[model samples]
Structure formats: C-alpha cells, structure tokens
Target chain A: MFKAIITVKLRPSILDPEGKAIEHALQSLDYTALSCVRIGKRIELQVDLDDRAAAEAAVDEACRKLLANTVMEDYTFELQKA
Target chain B: MSKVKFGVVVFPGSNCDHDAYHAVKHVLGSQAEFLWHKEGDIGGADVIILPGGFSYGDYLRCGAISRFSPIMKEVVSHAQRGGHVIGICNGFQILSESGLLPGALLRNQSLNFVCRHVHLRVENATTAFTNQYASGQVIEIPVAHGEGNFYTDLDTLAEIEDNGLVAFRYAERDGTITDEANPNGSLNNIAGIINREGNVLGMMPHPERVVEQLLGSDDGIGVFASLINAISGDVTIPGVAVLP
Candidate 1:
C-alpha cells in the first residue's frame, strides 16, 4: 500500500482573498513582520497499489482530474510506501 | 413554431433548478423539465441550463467535484455539438471546471458572500443569448455568491477581449464600467461571457430570479426571450400596456 500526500494552492498570479483576511488579522495581533500570507489545502489519500510509481501516477491523475483546478490552482503530491 | 425545450440540470445541491424551471415553464411560457445530475443523456433539450448553488457541497472547490458528474459528460457533448448552454453562478464555476468556459471564478475580494441587485451593461447583444437586448443597454440582475470574481491568464483575457466574447460587464446605472460597480472584482468588470462559438454563456447573475415584475424587476425576461427567439424565431417581448 502507498500513501499519497497532496497539496493544492492557488497560483501566485491569482489573488487569495481569504489569505489576505488572515494577514490582516495577524497584523492586528501584532505579528506585523510577515509581508504575505497565502492559504491552501492538504489532502492525503491511501492507494492499494504494488509499486510506488503506479501509486504516484494514480495520485497525479486524481489531482489533475479532481483535487486541483489547473486554471487557477497548482498541485503537488508525494507518495510513500505504507 | 415549436416551443423551445429547456432542460434545467438539477445537481444534488442546486437550489436554483426550480427557479430556472419556473422561469421557463411559467414566466416564459415554454416547455421545461428537470434533468438529474446522474443521467447520462440530455433528454433532447434545445437549451441546457446549469443552475446556481453549491454542487456536491462544493467539495474540493466550487463546482470541481460536480464537474465529474455523469450529466456533465452529456452537457459537454451537447455544448460541443453547438447546442445552447448557460451556467449561472455556481454553474459558471462548473462550466469553467469542465473546460466549457474560458476562466475560473475566485473568492470575492471582500471575502464576503455578496447578494444584491447590480447593473450589467450588455456588451454583445448580437449573440444568441443577448439578441433581445439592445447593445450597451444596462439591465438590473441579482448576483449572490462569494466565489464570483472571474480570473483568466493574461493571454486568454486578451483573446477574450479581442474576440468580443464578453457578453455583459458590471456597470453603473448609467452604464459606465467602474471599479465601484464591480461586485466581485472580476477582471475587466466582467459579469458574463460567451464561448467563442457564441452558444455557451457563463454568468454570475441569476437572470432566472428576476424574470417577473413581481419579483423586483422584469429585466431578466430579455435573456429568456432572446433564447426563445433564437430557437423558435418568434417571441414577443413582454411589456407594460395601459390595459386598453
């Protein structure tokens, strides 16, 4: 079995409104040194595959097809044997 | 002339499906039906309306998981066949996710769910969906959503403008495009856009919700009338008359 860890984030060019709100909140709390803050999601999945390469391929496909919207977001994944 | 058949796709979380159906069946006096999301066929609809609301509970992202619904395959094929398709609000997000539309909707710059009436200037009235409205006309439509800020690559944005694909732009009551008139900070104040082929439109406004004067404004009736006229070639725009 393999476990795949995926991270999805809005592209740098796209504006992150929620992140901006968080940044404002942090500033209010006196954490004023931080210049920027962007938010994203981390998804973990378990794949019952024999080979690491096969598991990686499956995870990549899942990300491309569903987990990530390539139009405004980017995704990266790492697979480890379980 | 035959009545234009409208199929309102009912995704699991779609709240506007009934509104769309009512607008077509009652307000517009046309044939309308509900198409469940799991069905693989379009049921011979001349126009397919992907109504608003969070589909699949907006999992992953707005309209991402719902794009994989079985009905979406048929919707894509229908769009490829040059049939008419309109995605309103969340439906717009689904169309972008399914690659039917050019851009994606992002969270509003204010990070708040905005719900109110806004003016939209008709940018391209020559298309199948805007023929009933005069060019440069400002119409009032209600928009309700958080993820309505439209975004695209700069190259695609240039192409969309060069091709005149923008159908409507957020504007002042007098039809001036300005940042203050923009409800969601969409690029170029875009409120609606048509596909290159001019048959598919994805917009953030709920035209179906305002088709009757009783609801607030009948400005949205033009959109349905335009579609009906495009399909059946004979629809008279409803108007106020001094009761004989």
Candidate 2:
C-alpha cells in the first residue's frame, strides 16, 4: 500500500484570521518576537496501489479536485510505502 | 423562454431548496422546479438558483465539494449563455468556487454563525435582480451563515468596484455604508455581487426567508420580483400582486 500525506494552507497573501487571533493570544502569554503566524491542515490518505508514481498522481488529482481549494489555498503532498 | 421558469438546485445537504422553491413558486408567482445536483440537466430552466445549506457537510471548504456537482457544468454554460443565476449563502460560495462569480466567502470574522436581518444598500440597480429597488436603496435581508466573510485580491476588488459589479453592501438602516455595519467583515462590506456579464449574482443574504410580510418584512419580495422581471421583462406576476 502507498500512504500519502497532504498539507494544505491558505496562501501567504491571504490573511489567516483565525491564526491571527491565536497569535495574539500567544503574545499575551509572552510568546512575542514571532512576526507572523499561519494555520493549515494535513490529511493522510492510504491506497491499495503499490506504485509510488500512480499513488502520487491520484493524490495530486485529489488535491486539485477536492482536497484543496486553489482559490485561497495551496497544497503539497509526499508519498511513501505503507 | 417566453415564460419565467425558475430552477432551484438541491444538493444532498441542501436545506433551503424548498424555501427557494416556495419563494419562486408562490411569492414570485412563477413555475419552480427542483434540479438535483447529481443530474446533469437543468430541465431547460431559464433562471437557476443555488440554494443555501451545508452541502457535502462543508468538507474542505464551504461550497467546495458542491461546486463539482454534475449540475455545475450546465450552470456555467447557462450563465455563459445569458441565463440568470442566484446563489444564496452557501450557494454564493459555490458560485465563487465555480468561477461563475468572483471572490470567495470565508469564515465569519466573529467566528460565529451570524443570523439576523441586516441592512443592505443596493450598489447597482441596473442588474436584473436589483431593478426593483432604486439605486442606493437600503433593503433589509436576513443573513444566516458561519462562513460569510467575503475576500478577494486588491486588483480584483478594484476592478469590481470600478465596474460597479457590487450589487449590495452591508449598510445602516439610514443607508450609511460603514465598516461598523459590516456583519461578516466582508471586504468593503460586500453583501452581494454580480458577475461581469450582469446575469449571475452571489450573495450571502437569504432573501428566500422573508418573502411574506407575516414573516416580519416583505422587503425580500422585490428581489424575487426583480428576477421574475428579468425572465419575462415585465412585472405581471400570474397570481401575485406586482408590489409597488
């Protein structure tokens, strides 16, 4: 089996409002000096396919089609044998 | 298209499809049909409406999965062919994701599901949906959503503003457009916008909810009337009085 890990994040140009609120809370607790903060999500997918190439292609298709909204976010994935 | 045929799209999780259907059928005095998302046909609908709901359980993003519904291809073509389309709340997000309309709707700034009647200023009255209201008229519409914050890049925002594509903006009851009045923190307090062709409209407000005066206000009737007017190019509603 092949396992793919995908990381999705809002584009840097876009404001992460939720992340910003967290950053402010962190500052209140004395975790300053961090100039910026962003938030994202990760998804892991396992398929029965043994070929790394095909597994990666399928994951990419998933990201482009439904896993990630390219309008305001970007996605990257890594695949490995399961 | 001699008659105004309204099509209300229904995704698996769509809860407002019936509200939209009732508003079109009874309030606007027109024939309304439900278009299933899995179906590829629009049943020759002249006006298509994407009603609001937690489609696909709001997976990945609001309206993200629903935009890929087989019905969307027909929607895009219909819009391209000068057909009128309205997306309310979740439907608004789908239109943005489908590229039928510009910009995107994000999580509400307050991180809460805002449900209330908000004053909206008609930014442009020339479109088929806003002709019933005078330019800059303030109309009360209910917005109920957790992810209604509208966002867009600066250039695209400027272009829409320059072209008067903004159909509505959050405003005060007295018609003042201010940042304080923005319920969702949408860019420029945008509540509704039309596509460049002026045929497609995507708004976060729910005009379908307040069609009757018994429900509190009859202000929303104008929106439906504007749409019926667009379809028939006349104000003669079959069984309903043409509200003045």
Candidate 3:
C-alpha cells in the first residue's frame, strides 16, 4: 500500500485573499516577521497499488484533472510506502 | 424560421437551472429543456446555458469537479461545432475550468460574498450574445458570487483584447469603465468575456434573473434576444459561423 499526499496552492502572481487575511491576523498577534503568506489545501489518499511507477502517474493525473486548477494554482504530490 | 431552441444544463447542485429555463420559455416565448449533467447530448438546442449555483457542492474548486462530468464532454463537443454556449456565475467558472473560456475566477478581492446590482458596458456588441445592445451601452445586471474575480496571464489578456473578445465590462451608469465600479475586482474590470470564436460566453452576472421587467431590470433580455437573432439568421451575424 502507498499513501499519496498532495498540496495545492495559488500561484505567487495570483492574489490570495485568505492568505492575506491570515497575514494580517498574524501581524496583529505581533508576528510581523512573516510576509507573503499563502493558503493552500492538502489531500491524502491511500492506494492499494504496490508499484511506485504506476502510482506516480495516477497521482499526477488526479491533481491535474480535478484536485487543482492549473490556470491559477500549482500542485505537488509525494508518495510514501504504507 | 423554426423557433430557436434553448437548453439549460442541470448539474447535480445547480439551483439556478429553473431561472434560466423560465427566462427562455416564459419571458422569451421559446422552447427550453433541461439537459442532465450525466447525459452526453444537448439534443438540437441552438443555445446551451450552464446555469449558476454550487455545482458538485463546489467540492474541489468552484468548477473543478463539474468539468469532468459526462455532460461536459458533450458541451465541449457542442462548442467545437460552433454551437452557442453561455455560462453565468458558477457556470462561468465551469467554462473556464472546462477550457471553453480563458481565465479563472479567483476569490473576491474583499474576501466577501457580494450580491448586488452593478452597471455594465457592452464592450463588444458583435457576438451572438451581445448583439442586442449597442456597443458601449451601459446596462444594469445583478451579480451574486464570492469568487468572481477574473484573472488571466499578461499574454492572454493582450490576446483577448486584440481579438475583441471582451463581452461585458463593469462600468458606470453613463458607460464609463472605472475601477470603483468594478464589482469583483476582475482583471481589467471584466465582468464577462467570449472565446475567440465567439460561440462561447462566460459572465459572472445573472442575466436570467433580470429577463423580465417585473424583476427590476430588463437589460438582460437583450442577451437572449441576441441569441435568438443569431440562431434564426434573420440578421447578418458577425461571429459564430454555425449558421447553415
């Protein structure tokens, strides 16, 4: 078994409204050192496939087709043996 | 000429399907039918509308999941054949995700769900969906959405402008495009746009809700009228070579 962990976030050029709000809250809490904060989503899935090569391709396809909007967002995934 | 047929697509979570259907069947006095999202055909409809609402519960993204549904394949094929397709609000997001239109709708700049009426300028009145209004005419339309901010790359922005594909721009009552008048901070204050072929239109405003005078503003009827005119071929349509 393998566990696929994926993270999706808006591109740096695109505005991140939620991230900006978080940045403001952090600053109010006296965490002025942080800047350019970005908000993203994390998805984890456990697959029964035993082959690593086939798992990579399937994870990538899932991210591109539904998990993320490539126009303004970027995604990355990592596979770990379960 | 045979009556121009209209189809309103009904995705799983689409709540505005009836509004679009009513606009065509009642207000415009045309035949309209609901096309299920699971089906792969749009029948003989000349114009297909992807109505608003949280399709697929906005699960992955506003339109990410709905684009993969079986019906979208048919919608794409229909557009490829030069059939008219319009996406409003959530529908607009779906069109963008489905690659029927360029640009993606991002979260509102203010991080709020804005619901109100705003003035819009008919930027290009030559397409099948905007021909009823004169170019630069200011019209009132209502917008309701949290993620209506339209974003595109610099290259795509220049391409759309060069192609005259911008269909509607938020503007003042006198038809002056201004930043303050923009409802969602959409790039270039764009409220709506069309594909290069002009058969596909995606806008963040709800035109169907304003199709009747009793609904407060009838400026939206012009959009439906334009579709009817283009499909009937009673006039020389400048775009969409689907006329046979």
Candidate 4:
C-alpha cells in the first residue's frame, strides 16, 4: 500500500480571510513580528496499489479532479510506501 | 410564444430550490419544476436555475462536490448550447466550479456570513437576463453567503471587463460604486457576471427572494421578467448567435 499526504492551499494571489482573522488573533496575543498566516488543508490517504508510479498517477489525478480546485488553490502531494 | 419552462435543479442540501420554483411558477406565472441532481437531462426546460444552498455540505470547497453531480453534465451541455442558466449564491459557486463561469468565490473578507439587502447597479442590461432593466439602474436584492469574495487573476479580470461580461456591480442607492457598499469584497465590486456568450449568469445575490412586492421589494422581478421576455422574442440580445 502507498500513503499520500496532500496539502491544499489558497494561491498566494488569493486573499485568505480566515487566515487573516487568525493572524489578528495571534497579534492580539502578542505574537509580534508576524508577517503572515495563510491556512490550508492537509489530507492523508492510503492507496492500495502495487507500483509507486501507478500510485503517483492515482494520487495526482485525485488531487486534480477532487482534492483541489486549480482555479484558486494549489496542491502538492508526497507519496511513500506504507 | 410558448410558455417558458424554468427548471430548478435540486442538489443535495439545496435550500433555495423552493424559492426559485415559487418565483417562476407563482410570482412570474411560468411553468416550473424541480430537477433532481441525479437526473442527467434538463427536462426540456428553457431556463435552468442552480439555486443557492450548502450543497454537499460545502465539503472540500463551496460547490466543489456538487459540480460533479450527474445533473451538472446536462447543465454544462445546456449552457454550451446557449440555453439560459442562472446560478445564485451557491449556484454561482457551482457554475464557477463547473467552468460555466470564470473565477472562484473565496471566503468573505469579514470572515462572517453576510445576509442582507444591498444595492446592485445593472452594469450590462443587454443580456437576456437583464434586458428589462436599464443600464445603470440600481436594484435592491438580498445576499446571503459566507464565501462570496470573487477572485480572479488580474489578466482575467481585465478580460472580463473588456468583454463586458460583468452583469451587475455592488453600488449605493444612487448608483455610486464604492468600497463601503461592497458586501463581500468581490473584485471590482462585481456582484454578478455572465459568460462570454451571455447565456450563463452566476451571481451571489438572491433575486428570487425579492420577486414579489409582498417580499419587501419587487425590484428583482425585472430579472425574471427579462428572461421571460428574451425567451418569448420580446427582447433582442445582441452578440449571441445561438442557432436553433
């Protein structure tokens, strides 16, 4: 089995209002020198496949089709034998 | 002219389907029916409405899962054929996800769910959906959503403006576009936009909720009236060459 860790994040050009709100909370709590705080989602799933190449393609397809919306978000994934 | 048929697609968790159906059938005096999401055909409807709601509980992202719904296939085909399609709020998000419209709706700048009536200036009144209203007319409509901040690349924004695809813009009562009047921080104060062909429109406001005078303001009736007029050949839409 292969395990994939996918991270989806809003693109740098897109505004992250939730992250901005959290940043304000951090600043209020005296977290000074904070440049920025952009939040994203991390999805971990296991793929039941034999070859690493096949598993890579499957995970990539999942990200492109369902896990991430390429219009406003970017996604990256790492695969490893489980 | 044959009576227009409006199809309101009811996706899982769509709360505004009834409102849309009522707006067309009772308020506008048209034939209206609900089209289940699992259905692949458009049910011979002239206008398709992707009503507002938290479809699929807005999992992953707003309108993300619903875009893959079976009915969306027909919806896309219908739009490609130059049939009229309007998506309001969550419907707008779905249209964006389905590639029927451009840009994505991000989280509101305030990080809160905004629900209230706002002024909208008719930016382009020549489209099939806005032909009843004069260009620059300000109409009052209610917007209810948490993710309505419209975002797109600078190049695409310029292209949308250059193509005159913007249908409505947030404005003041007297029709002044201002930052203070923008409810969701939509790019360029955009509240609604149409496809390049002008048959598909995705907007973040609920025009159906205000279709009757008893519902506070009847300004929204123009939206329905415009569509009925266009479909009945009472109004001519320029630049759209939909071969029947």
Q: lDDT of each model, Cα atoms only?
A: 0.90, 0.87, 0.89, 0.90
Which stretches of model 2 miss by more than 4 angstroms?
A30-35, A47-58, B237-244
Kindly provide the TM-score of model 4 when superposed on the true structure, using C-alpha atoms: 0.94
How far is A34's C-alpha from truth in model 3 (Å)? 2.5
Interface RMSD of each: 0.9, 1.5, 0.9, 1.0
TM-score of decoy 3: 0.95
Ranking by TM-score: 1, 3, 4, 2
CAPRI accuracy category, model 3: high
Number of clashes in every candidate structure? 0, 0, 0, 0
- Standalone chain B TM-score for every prediction: 0.96, 0.95, 0.94, 0.94
For model 3, residues B122-210, the per-residue Cα lDDT tens digits are: 99999999888888888888999999999999999999999999999999999888888987889999999999999999999998888
Q: What pairs collide in candidate 3?
A: none
Clashing pairs in 4: none
**Candidate 3's C-alpha lDDT?**
0.89
* Candidate 1 residue pairs in clash (backbone atoms < 3 Å): none
Q: Write the per-residue lDDT of candidate 4 for residues B1-244, one digit (tens) a residue.
A: 2289999999999999998998778776788989999998989999999999999999999999999999999999999898999999999999998889999999889888999999999999999988888889899999999999998888999999999999999999999999999998999999999999999999999998987667876777678778988898643323221121
Residue-by-residue lDDT tens digits, candidate 1, A1-82: 9888899999998888788889989999999898579899999989999988888888888888889988899998888889
Give the better candidate number (2 or 4) by lDDT: 4
Runs with alpha carbons beyond 4 Å of true place in candidate 4: B234-244
User: In model 4, what is the error at residue B16, expressed in angstroms?
Assistant: 0.9
Per-candidate RMSD vs. true structure? Answer: 2.3, 2.5, 3.9, 4.4
In the order shown, the candidates' DockQ scores are 0.85, 0.56, 0.82, 0.80
Q: Give the Cα error of residue B62 in candidate 2, in Å.
A: 0.7
